[model samples]
Target chain A: MHQAIAILDSGVGGLTVAKEVMRQLPQEEIVYFGDTGRAPYGPRAPDEVLKFTEQIVEYLLQFQPKMIVIACNTATAIALKHVRSQVNIPVVGVIQPGSRAAIKATKTGMIGVIGTENTVTSGAYPRALQELNPDTSVVSLACPALVPLVEKRLYRSDMARTVVSQSLQPLLNSPIDCLILGCTHYPFLAQMIAETVGPRVSIISSADETAREISTLLHHRGQLETSGKVPVHRFFCSGDPETFQAIALEWLGEQIKVSPVFWQMTRLSR
Target chain B: MHQAIAILDSGVGGLTVAKEVMRQLPQEEIVYFGDTGRAPYGPRAPDEVLKFTEQIVEYLLQFQPKMIVIACNTATAIALKHVRSQVNIPVVGVIQPGSRAAIKATKTGMIGVIGTENTVTSGAYPRALQELNPDTSVVSLACPALVPLVEKRLYRSDMARTVVSQSLQPLLNSPIDCLILGCTHYPFLAQMIAETVGPRVSIISSADETAREISTLLHHRGQLETSGKVPVHRFFCSGDPETFQAIALEWLGEQIKVSPVFWQMTRLSR
Candidate 1:
């Protein structure tokens, strides 16, 4: 029997990471939980995120997820430490995998990080970058509007380009060889960001790196799912199941069997 | 020659209508334009929504659509008159068909219209209802968060239910035999809204009625493209093209090809 991995995020941004894990770990049955109701965790407070994360983990544990991947940077930064202490299973956050990838990719030692305002304020990426490579210089900017923009399905247009340029104006002056898309949603806007920031700056996606990290950790810990014939990936959103499934099929390039699940808080209230 | 119909919206909600149109008219081609960059027109100022509508219509005219559908209620209310005066093609807004359907469905002649804040604020549905049946009572409520909540993909969660409940609280007191889902996005939340509003209220969807209207109009005008082997439906989003294509396939429910196009401001840019 193959072990199941539970991946949770505030919303669809984590799907990027989950898809990558599916590609790398073929045998594991992946369960995804997206908190679409209070998504874009960047602006949210730490305690709120911690509580949300706990609820998701507990929900996923009912299915016996062998490991829990906090696929969101904002939640991982604030909640992972506390979550690790409580859960018996292994927990992984995107910051370290992304930080390692950025440290390795940058030749100029100067990297640019674009994330939500709260994620930048958290100083999570900068700290991880510095810890990995002390001499590395990081220029971080919070794109306050980008997440909402992307969430609304706006990634093309002069307006989208204008917003991208405006958000990235400060980072342009720095000589950075690599740009880290600190938010998972940032990758969807990679084309506009790349055009504005110039092609020389390599765009690093945390989704890819985090997926790789999950596989390596599972292998080392002897928790890897080694058997399964055609694993099924189930996606549950606290939002529109159709839209989530649609975007997942597009992003994952697979006919994902997505079904609607009702999160009955009233039942839990009893 | 099969004439192409121009379907425009502030964003992806219109795709629901467009998908229906494609299903109903197989031989006819559709040119869908979503102003994804600055979407959720329902909450936007009437003037801004008007400007957006005009811009998209002007852009779509280059494709020479036989008719244009203002798939957005906010845009339809604000700009339908202006668009009709300027364009030679027949203009259809989701409002009239939906209002007509609600009026016909209601036994007590009390109709409730639920849509975005701007749509309800503009009194579009009320005006449409009164124009069709002067004696009918109209109750309108602004569902400000529903569009964004749906756009973010949170349709089936406790949070979604809570939001739906709160938004519909205003309508619960009013006696309505028929409830009109005035926005295209509203249909995605139909099941939940119906469950909350109870089984007594007959839920009216604008998309289905709008599709029927287009069929009738095209048939009367001799623009119906019948006897073709298969109809081609082309979807273009000012966002992630691949993502749009995937969601379209799921919504479209048939093996139809979806292609991407750049929303260029100028001819030279394209």
Candidate 2:
């Protein structure tokens, strides 16, 4: 499709997913929105997370995107089905793709999931994994401390490792051969997590699988972009542009301009 | 560059590298040659490996490639420097890229390497890792049995896990935070390896890093192909095309035509 693929997260965490999309589908343009102002939607109620997601999706509709990717686990957990019903185009959420990847990776049917409190409490991953294979045994942990560590840029610190170590003890005690990084923010702490968990567990991220799914869906629909033109990606954040740009550059491995996006309730009325 | 990037391996194992190159650089044409007739260069003499790598390099030169990648770890260990001196084009090898990735992934400064006998014996990974960081400790294992399993298409059986478990016992006993799948074929057995080693150890494969290095080199040299057309990849094997093509299709995730390449002794006379 000539139209861009729109993706949004609560904050810069979704850049992990965006980075994979760019690497796997270089020809397709991306319109990304990060609601950093009201980020860490992890602590919010489902109704508020859904409302925020709707606002961003509404804002993203101006790009005339062919697909929408709910890149944040919390947003995907609470808002995915609601947004899918509201949108005319394909709307993909992170949980299903992550669950599918874990299913494919695990030799044992036991899987561990760690995400924000909202995502874990909602039981999204366990439901998704069990639905895919009823025999799958899932251990879910709510890592409420991680998102703040990542957002504060303290992921590499000793304190972060201590937090990760303490949080993963229950799952580590289990027989999980695969662990899903349920939050988009969690991948930033992958090294620490892997170190704490040891060598036996395969860490599964939704970014690569989500990108592959998008490519497959686009190809099946004959909407795969075939033009030779270089794709220009646009980034927007409802918070400090400089902060967003810095994190985006660090995570995506490229320097790109970030523009500020303010929500206008009147725009939705139109 | 308009010309293709040439890659050669002792056998079908290098298809892993070829697969990554295709995924990451879709617009760049590839000329791949698999020296399957004299396959399993792992146990061969260093001088013999050098001679064979030179012959393949000479053969690939006829394609007018802009860069050459020594996709086999054994060939890289024995002949990379010699091959680089002989060719004017940039030559990339698997060992350095894989070592760099391992160094980046390891948290304990303890790394493990699993490869063919020649690769492990060459002490290439230890040298590379130590050169990058002197404090880094490396545990090298020669998993000579694994390549045969992959080549024989027996990688998915229970026997494969048994083989992997037996092979990785020493590394599992160590404090390694990362394990390098030094041979390209090793990635095919990654699931089993991960299960044997457990979840704490990160698996590092050179394919993705090698592709990135190729991209960086091409970009730096102003040789990156910016054409929007789908690049066609050519495959040649010095042995049975049917066997190589089946493995290539399975490993590369695409249907491709494999051409038989006979070693003409008289061609070297020119």
Candidate 3:
């Protein structure tokens, strides 16, 4: 049996990454764990987010994935290093790929980033961008209200436009030519974001870049699936399975059955 | 053993479709045959194109594919129904999906289509658009020169820009809000095409839509790969393996090994 790629996130936001992984590396089986029960890790403390991420990674380890993808921006900002140290297999995060894309996409060396408050405050994007190109100018904003709208499935609603417009007003004033949808959930609001920023600004989503990185890594490691077989993707949500399934189907453009993953604080040791 | 999705085209043009299928359904093994030796089916007689398509289909049938995708526009325009009649498995074409995407994308109902001389002359897109939405006004241009440029790997060259500018000059004059890269190879010149048409026109490529259609068909038929394994993709070319391999790697974003598929005129009867 080929080892699967394990991906974990705070909630359904990670589904964006999973969708891209499915698109770019369709042959690799995926074992996805979305900690939807205690989701919206955006507002949570770093220690709490790190703890939850570790717990989910430990849970996913049972399937013996060859690599791990931290699909959530908040969790990645807080827990990527900790998770990497804890896991024996390769672990990837959304930040580096996203930052790299912004750095490459920006013609003016002026880039803007939008994410949850925690991720923005963490300054991951700015740090990554500056490290990549020292002369780059990074402007980041925290759209704290956007995730809840997404969770409530109001991404296509008029209210989403208003929210996106108001949130992006500051960034629009900046001279940035590229806007990074720093949070995975922000991709759902991409249309409104695009409309608000107009065509001049390129919206960079980490999903595609992240998927490419995973593919390149798998190939170089000789872990890419080369057999003639279709991969079975497994989804586990610590929250409502039905809700997760619906969103997964919508985002993936296919019918998918999602299973519930029950966890408790006491089960952390196991 | 899992069955592969069989895709055939006149030449490397189908690599665009193959690339999308890999991105959208990465887990499913693909058996791709490019009839490159006798390619540029665009200018060939319909009967000759049909006969070549049938022979490729017959050769691919040996792989026991679960479905067939006619990735070439000329083949799709002329031989889709014939191919479907010959094969028992699910068969998909690029024209309908591309037409549907154009319909969905166009706000002004004024659409532009660019393809080889055969596809444009066949009136496939115009007919498809009219059949779906009579209100749609379709403008098509026969880009007879573009394919050879692609075959010779001049897609990103200054010559490509000049060629694209010349071909698109008529369409740009029209009120077309959306332009369809009707030929599979046209996607290679997408940047040049987009530059010629400017940012107002949405460039529609059938690759993603075709991949989605295949996914939907496979899922509905309960044929989606649910196994936790990696799929190995096979490539066959009735032309130069080295040339095909170079293009495949560049287009697919991975290093792929290509095998030669020799054909004889006498074997048509068998």
Candidate 4:
């Protein structure tokens, strides 16, 4: 029973980060929470998102997690600092890791970001990127249309490609060599995004980069699991457990137990 | 004045890291030390490498650097922990960063490592890889020939291509999807190395990855330089200043001022 990394996301969008964490650090146990009942926190107001994130963190504290990852882009942009102030443990957000990665990957000094309405409006990507390298030119697009499609499990549909193409048209004209998938949900549509963006621009999955940084932070803290034991992952979602279970299975590419889970998360109300 | 990242290597190998730091964090200043007189610490005794690395750190401490990067793999394998005990600031080593990157990139779980004699013999890569993931399969090959070519600036010669092919012959057959350029110098021959190993393997440059982690560490510590002023980098070499300057200019692809230097490093005598 290793002290797990507690990861909280608005919905299955963060399944991308969880999948990478599972692949990259196989021995570490994961306790993931997806607030699918309030799925697509992107278009929501900042204070509401922050309150919801705080509720999830409070719920996860019962596990005595060694670290907390705000895996949802919208949630990370809104509540990362607030969450860090609340917890004594290491709190990692999806923003800075993606920003650092884009800074590493970009050759043109111009970078592109596509996220939710809340994330883009918060101006987190530009602030994060420029904070690391002030000279970086950031072009941000709010893909408010994409996350709902993912939450609804329509990311594989032809409509996803259509929405993705139409939404990305403004950015294709820019001279960015590296595009940071500012939203975690975007990696689910990565293939369609890549084909639309062409071969020159590199597509950076913030979720994957965040997973790599989690390994870095854990390594520096000397908390990396050295055990040979296979980890049994636990997942909790606030919405339809069946829909969550279906999404988790398809995205994580494995059997993830998400049953016997009551959606009583509203009890931790503000 | 922004505190600089102090980088030390056994000749120009760590220039790969320094170059990346400059490129990725353009605003951050760098203080680089190249112990060219004691070049190729690869085949040296671990005690000797450790002693030499300590001497460089002692000399670098005069500048009050915020971070000390043991950019040389051989020296890092010998001295990272010991140096961390001596310095209050963060001490970064190249090995773990590369190991983490390889883990992230490797789909087959079979990873390859190519480094100098000391780094290979230290079993650092395997330990680092397995520490993060107990299931990772690591195959390490010590390419003692690559570093010397880089030291002599012969990395571009036809000899380099032939030597790279001959040296990497044992690894080509391994079912590895990612090859960690374990030695900082190996990136100099990365082109030939990549060609010889074919496109099946993703080349993981520890030097570049180490620079990326340096940013992550600084960001977490809230020490990333925010001033818009351009950074003036300093270079010092214990051996011939002229040869060191020549290699610096070529490797860094920028004008590096290395002059008015007396080779009195023996003053930090044991």
Candidate 5:
């Protein structure tokens, strides 16, 4: 079986990026693994995220995917470097892709990054942005509540908007012209953030940039799926499969069938 | 710090019960811990739920509560027995309280139980109800999607209502005069369920019964707060405090300030 591109995240947040990949690469089959069992990797220690990321990647490798996308900001922050080294396939994280997109889009060299606490604290985006443009100034904020708020489908609620406004106030105060949603889940709340920051700030979801990166990596490696076979995306979670499927349908629409893969940790070998 | 009643659940579904406790015992202070970080304990292995429940209990003990309420059906199904023996403070799980209430309300001696897959699979309620009255007939249905539906706040959505109605159709075929919302989170979806089941079947929330049990246990143990103290209700989560607080206000209302506790693992163990 030809392994498709494998995308892994701590939870449903990665679906935003996965959806983007599907839209861009309709011919490429995808396998998505969401570690919904132990999610919100934002608050966990970096070591734990590394451990969790490794487990999921190893699980996905059984499918022999051509590439892997670490579609979580927290994992990208702490585990991407280690993960890339461990996996035989090329592993891409969203942070650098998003940072590059923001740097290119920002005219004033003022960029903003918003994600979970762990992602912001890691200074992953600022470092990546600075690497691209040393003179660029980056403002990063941790919108911890935004993910759950989106999970609750409270994006349109005034209360949710108010909370987003309050959380993004500091970032809005800066002279940033481009705001990077450092976390894949953050894009779900992009409308609220965009509304709060006004129209001047361009909101860039890492999901889009990551998809582009996947396409680029696959193209460069000459590993793009060319069989013209109909793509089927498979989803698995360590938590509730039915629940994960329901949320996936809601976020990705009802057209797709996201099945649950019950993952059991058999053995962890380095 | 004066100790208050501490209630722990897998997620915000327990807020329905916490709100009732607040309403019934206005003078008593309440502290809530929702493992929104890792919720929907229904399908998880019994041992996993038990471990998570104990961890939360241990965390809540730092507040030095006189008693603990396991406001989660999955937790109650497996952990209550072990939890009771482990804690010096009386620990009351929702299952027995809910079962007793359903048995009392059912004039037809026919009862219905709706919970997560694991909860129903455990046959805990069937055994408990039978122990109370061998003549009583019980119908149990595993609502795997109910938690996610509740989490998304789509209780009233046509899709959610349709799912609930379909899942409950089997129980509707029975002669149950009273239906137990076996999972604490199920109560939030109560209004939709009540409407679906119509006016015939009485719907009982484990949260309410658990609150009542807490009141009774407190009185019996001489731990009930009698100073008419308008206690400050504090909220904590292992995940995002902002998301937890947002859901708290959404479900229970914005009348109270939901504050975040800095989560330090070592600090929690104290």
Candidate 6:
């Protein structure tokens, strides 16, 4: 009778958060939705991202989850507050968690953020970090190429290293001690980014940090699952099921079954 | 007029949390109480520890703080749930934060905890970790000598190194990736401990973790300080003011002041 934690993302990127939740909280159940069909939400308009996010959350709500997690930085930057206002359960976003972890890890107030175009344009990481501490200084860059690499399930390909290196060229000279992986998709390329940035800059992944936030919030509310039984997690994707399953299996390192879902497509292309 | 976050502890050990909160959320005002007169709650009975914690919380409540943090491991182990039941505001403890951090940092499910005698005897760290994920394996050691070194503000002395090494001798063979500084006081000697354990074991300071928890809870509730003004923090200790001031100034790396408070000295001689 345990209520699952509902997680929604733009695509397979959130499998990072989902994997962490499963590892850190083995007893808890999860219901996940990945909107892969319309992903690279990175380049989409805010209104459209927000609308898509609302639709995904509405679909997941039927699971009667105890908590809702917006596991995509693009969606979170645009829709976290809106989703929070709409839900009775607690709504968690990827931005603030990464911001908090970076604040903790950074000795210098200079923090770096690399996210999707939407998250960068929204100035969400800067806003989140500065909101907690006004003295914090942030530098942001949008790494638009990284998300599609993950969506296509090719993060391990040598081409990912090239795209990551190119996208992160501008941040190489920044004096930040800690870099926030502001896009959930960026974690798929973490090794390449880490090698590029070297050990001096600690990397803060929003995908991992969001899992901690969920654990903390659920524990405080006395909503943590303690059934001591293996939980059956369900995952859905509004796109090609085989592609989503392939990416999920690779990212999560488990043979998980994914259900295909359909959604209405709108045509205001950028 | 900003409402303060009230923090209570057995002694200056709580300053670890205070320092983190100051560094992480500079805009939030803090009101701190340290029961230095009853300094070593770690060796005291659970009932006595709980009573002392209640008295400190009672004194701190006069500020009408927005939140309460039980920053001492001993007091938190014995009094956290009781205090939560009595207060309306969110009550945070150091144990869970350290536990969560250790869980996240561990590649092996094996975790290590070093705390006060009471914290170890109470089995709070094991409970906190296993409660979240039953697969977690924890090894606990009660470093009773460590608190006195920090309390006396002698953590930098040559004798402190010998004492820390002797105390950590038992854990030398454990296969843990991350070690939890279960006692708040332990962070004062973090450098020496790190040197002793070598680089393989990652050290976690519960003091720093608790600050993250406070930030997360406040943000979720939309109660984060947005005044954008430099906050004035207040600290009180029930022991000799000079000793506490020396420790506070040294640990916090600032020329700040501490107020001396007196409590009814209970005759329950341990």
Residue pairs of candidate 5 with colliding backbone atoms? none
Enumerate residue pairs that collide in model 3: A23-B23, A26-B26, A26-B27, A27-B26, A27-B27, A227-B232, A232-B227
Chain A superposition TM-score, candidate 4: 0.97
Report the error of model 1 at residue A216, Å. 0.8
Q: Which segments of candidate 4 are over 4 A away from where they belong?
A: A259-263, A268-270, B259-263, B268-270
lDDT of 6 by residue, B47-92 (tens): 9898888877888889999999999999889999999999898999
Better-scoring candidate (TM-score), 3 or 6: 6
> lDDT score, residue B148, model 2?
80
Single out the weakest 10-residue window by summed lDDT for candidate 3 chain A: A261-270
Q: Could you report the DockQ of all the candidates, in the order they appear?
A: 0.01, 0.02, 0.02, 0.78, 0.01, 0.86
On residues B1-270, what C-alpha lDDT tens digit does candidate 2 reach at each position?
489999999888788888777655656799999887777888988988898899989989999999999999999999988998898888988887777667545668889999999999999989877754566789999999998888777888889999999988877778889899999888889889998999999988876657655654564356867665677899988877888888877888789998887644335324
Q: Is the docking of candidate 3 incorrect, acceptable, medium or high quality?
A: incorrect
Model 3 per-residue lDDT tens digits across residues B1-270 = 599999888889888988877654556789999888878989999999998898888888999999999999999999988887787898888997788667656778899999998999899999877654566899999989998888777787898889888877778778899999998988888888888899999998876557656765564356876463577999998878888888888888889988886554346435
- CA lDDT scores, all candidates in order: 0.76, 0.83, 0.82, 0.90, 0.77, 0.90
- How do the residues B154-179 of candidate 1 rate in per-residue lDDT, one tens digit apiece? 66567988899888998887899989
lDDT of 3 by residue, A54-138 (tens): 8888888899889999999999999988887887888888997777657555678898899999999999889766654556789
Candidate 4 lDDT tens digits, B1-270: 579899999888999999999888888999989888888999998998998898889988998999999999999999999999998999999999999999998888999999998899999999999888888899999999998898888989999999999999999789999999999998889999999999999999999999999999988888989898888889888888887888888988877887423544666342
After superposition, candidate 1 runs with Cα above 4 Å error: A156-159, A264-270, B1-270
What local lDDT score does residue A198 receive in model 2, on the 0 to 100 scale? 86
Superposition TM-score, candidate 6 onto the true structure: 0.97
Candidate 4, residues A147-199: lDDT per residue as tens digits? 98898999999999999999999988889999999998899999999999999
Worst 10 residues of 2 chain B by lDDT: B261-270
Per-model TM-score on C-alpha atoms: 0.48, 0.53, 0.55, 0.97, 0.49, 0.97
| Model 2 ranges with Cα > 4 A deviation | A1-270, B265-270
Residue-wise lDDT of candidate 6 within A173-207, one digit each (tens)?
99999999998888889999999988999999999
Better of 3 and 4 by DockQ: 4
